[model samples]
Target: MATSWRTIGFEKNKKLFERAIEGGELGHAYLFSGPEMIGKRTLAVEVANKITNISVPDILMITSAGSESGQTIAIEDIRKIKNFVSIRPYGGAYKFIIIDDAHLMPETSQNSLLKILEEPNASSIIILVTACPEALLPTITSRCQEIQFFPHPRTIMESVLAEAKLSKANKEFLADFADGRLGLVKRIIEEDSFGEIEGAVKKIMYLAKADINERLDAAQKLTDEKNKAGLPRLVLYWMLYLRTRLSEPKAQKMLSGLLALNEIVNKPQYNHRLALENFLISL
Candidate 1:
């Protein structure tokens, strides 16, 4: 049977796993950091399984002190864990706590957790997983052994896509648009949302090439679809496309316009329709 942690290609982290398995050098606390959907939590869970030898259960597990059933890890959840750590393990040699989305833990909660890290219980391990490690407090980070996970290469991504039985055309588009995020590829394939997004992109491109009102209309539609993020992304792509097909001065103007529009959309108070209208008028 395939091991849980071994499923996501941890060859590069093999040494770390081996050391942990060997037992003596295992750290009391670990921070697993990587982009979202890159299997950080999977590795953490595998480690927990190996340590606890607990039969895999579908329950939501957390490390916080006060979390009720179904609640994600909260400050109270961390508080609840302190009592468990003081006790000895019943089944396995070690007790493991896997904290998912540790970066989302508030400062007070993280600070509360720091005390446990500073004086870790023997035979207990805490694994913290997060997509944005930098957002975590320095004190908490400094107390834990950090492991960083990088995106898989294109070749590996292609292999994963093949295993999923995705169409070749869809796979290529996903590979380009997902920025090596396998999670995104899985979502796109499962939902079959690529065609809709592609149609929207094409419509926006056509509008960009038409009159100012057309561009404004396209922007409004984009915002309506909750694709505000895609607006700047598409504009950048369109500007580059135009650069390849137009003179230097025209390309420069397009780049400047795209950049201005990007800034407008990025503003927290941006009036989407008004901003789009202004951008269209400028174009």
Candidate 2:
């Protein structure tokens, strides 16, 4: 019944949206940009919910892309949004079109979105959420009001974990390991899928010191599809692990290698095994 952003940790973004809503200056389109799992999508949804008076779950026009969507927001997705925007609101005065991972839209699809942005829709709001806004066209970004989300402060994250009623050990693990991503913490806690990452983080040190055979063994083990699901999390934890070792001379180089490998693994056409092996052996 009330418009609230308790689910998001970014205070500035909350205030910004609140102001826009209160002033009746809410824009026709907005771009929400931030790091992965840093709450861009959450804030985008909340903004849409507030403006359209549509209960969060009932907002049928919302769209999101993921690995299953082939990692790109296709032209068909844009077409659906175009159709949604053309329709009038069912119950409320406003309707919404929220697209997550908007940057994943290739140039052509982005052009389709551009057509919508250029044509004014009085009753519709479009929100584009992405971790990689650079992948989107400059014109698309220029058409929308851009809002940036950032990692939650450590104090805020700690308070959130404390309220989750986790065990002391688990609480501490999340506190040290969350890296300001509450989404990641929740996923790891609820799914119990983080064990592989924990082990991998510990093994990173060993892998760094490991010889050719050990490195090759790790590369082989890590390249499986079953294990690939966990690689992103593992790389994330590895980056956090590197944070602690920044005092060492090789820390930057190690992190650079991991970042490069991460980029490769995220692309559909890249060879995950070769990238993993290259990073491991180089370490």
Candidate 3:
């Protein structure tokens, strides 16, 4: 298969696109949505190369210029792609435009891209990659075929960790801490503090099972002003822990709380500290 370059654990996604190609039903634009480091960009690039039969880096690749601290995909970037796609492919069946972290494109940039999607060139393909699709306009999503990437299965994660020569004990710990997010696991391991983080998570898990006052005290400490930067990581660890406890009926009851906590942390308007504290205290 042309998309064989896709990383492990994306076989199903590769097959889906393969089937689309076989049926001559491959869409002009595709939205690849998922958590960070789940192979969305790799799959998108591989699929683009396959469909275009082009391997030229500069001619076929169009990447978004965005940053974590709120730099967005600008209108100028979209205009460049708009003009590029209008031209015929240099030496391929299709021209490819990939917008990484596309959800960060400001509303104006999204609107600008919408125009291109509306009048897509016959020999061009656009792929939008994002972790948070809800941030994108509905019109943009509605116009493109959506592909979702999820966390890898435990078996695949274990294989990847093994390839990296991680110890068996560390592999088991990361497999749980990452909740199937291979990129996160890799990052944690490279940081040399995975053991410390793991220990802290275990202590938090114990607090989750403790009495109300004890839980509240722990939450207060976790959400302390100076420790604010770590709150998100703390919440993520708890979510991973909660995932394992889902088989328990009592744990199942906290799903709503988890969702609420996740929402509060993601949105800036909410007092995330208070929200997290309330959720943890309740647990």
Top candidate on TM-score is 2
The segments of candidate 3 whose C-alpha lies over 4 angstroms from its true place after superposition are 1-3, 58-71, 189-238, 241-258, 261-283
Instruction: Compute each candidate's TM-score over C-alphas.
Output: 0.64, 0.83, 0.70
Window of ten residues with lowest summed lDDT in model 1: 63-72
Off by over 4 Å in 1: 1-5, 56-60, 63-73, 190-283
Query: Candidate 1, overall lDDT?
Result: 0.66
Give the poorly placed runs of model 2, Cα more than 4 Å off: 1-4, 55-69, 202-231, 263-278
Worst 10 residues of 3 by lDDT: 62-71
lDDT of 1 by residue, 136-204 (tens): 789999988899888767787788887777677877766665656665566667878667566645654
lDDT of candidate 3 over 88-199, digit per residue (tens): 7866667888888786577888899999999988888888987778878899999999999998998988887887767788778777767778767767777776766767
Best by lDDT: 2
Query: How many clashes in each structure?
Result: 9, 0, 0
Clashes of 3: 0
The lDDT values for all models are 0.66, 0.75, 0.74
**Per-residue CA lDDT of candidate 2, range 1-283, in tens?**
3555567578878888788778888888888887677677777777677776754432544343333444556677788776776777876767777787676576778898899899968888888887767777899889989888778888888887888857888888777777788877777777775575668677898898989999998888877755765566577778877866778979889988987876665543467788899899888
